[model samples]
Target: MVNIPRLPTATQAPQRPKRTDKQRKAEQAAAPVSQPTVVAKAVAETIKDPAFIEEVQARVQYDSPQGKNKQALSAYLDVLHQAKREEYSHLLGVDFYV
Candidate 1:
């Protein structure tokens, strides 16, 4: 047998009321202001680089092959070349023929 304390049903802490729509809207509107805009700026900067975009597209293609075929091998090699070129360009800060 377990001994349990019995208390008056009327003795309880008050619960917080649900937020009103206006209060919720105010909170949502204020939430984004403090976050740094650096992520958006970085994304914008990244998209503006054609080399980076090409490299990314190539990588996606290289990784998503449905079958092992000559075409797939050729495409994978092409993407690898593009990735190397992008890396070299980034290192030199300028395009150079290799």
Candidate 2:
């Protein structure tokens, strides 16, 4: 009778190195962060412009529903306008509430 060599089992498979907490943390820290959204940039630009508010005021009737929506948007733009350029500058990079 002929005898054949046995194949390697799972127990004999090569093992990979386990990552340390420091290495894991380093990898996480090295990851790139997300940038600001398009809406935020547009809001920032609108905040810098005075004519935008005037244009909204000119086109919308204060009593109508559509006008109310415009008013709300205009008010929010006003808030962004009144906010300190230095203090809220970081918020300009965000899409919504900062």
Candidate 3:
């Protein structure tokens, strides 16, 4: 039998340092501190606004016989139910269906 040359085994090479510890520490220190901004404060106020919530509820509840017969309301409800079921299933690992 003729002698066969041996192939080199695959191996991982040493990785180079991407960033130094001082650089990482400086970046961490320079990171933006979490504080509520004007937009965030406005959002919180809007959420707590009773009139806004009431208006939204009124719009959701205001349904005509024609709209109900056309399954528009039912379709919206079904979509909401499906989304909630999916969220619950992801959290609890249970089969959720409407």
Lowest lDDT sum, 10 consecutive residues, model 2, at 89-98
User: What value of lDDT does candidate 3 attain over all alpha carbons?
Assistant: 0.83
Candidate 2 residues 1-98, lDDT tens each? 34456954445568899999999999999999988899999999998899988898799865544767888987887788665644555666643343
Give per-residue CA lDDT, model 3, range 1-98, as digits (tens). 35457955566899987998999999999999999999999999999999999998887854465755769777887887887788889999999655
Off by over 4 Å in 2: 1-28, 64-98
User: How would you encode candidate 1's per-residue C-alpha lDDT over 1-98 as one tens digit per residue?
Assistant: 45457944454689999999999999999886666589998999999999999999887745444556767887778877998888889998999664
- Identify the superior model by TM-score, candidate 1 or candidate 3: 3
lDDT of 1: 0.81
* Pairs of colliding residues, candidate 3: none
TM-score of 1: 0.32
> For candidate 3, what's the RMSD?
12.5
**Candidate maximizing TM-score:** 3
In model 2, state the lDDT of residue 79.
81
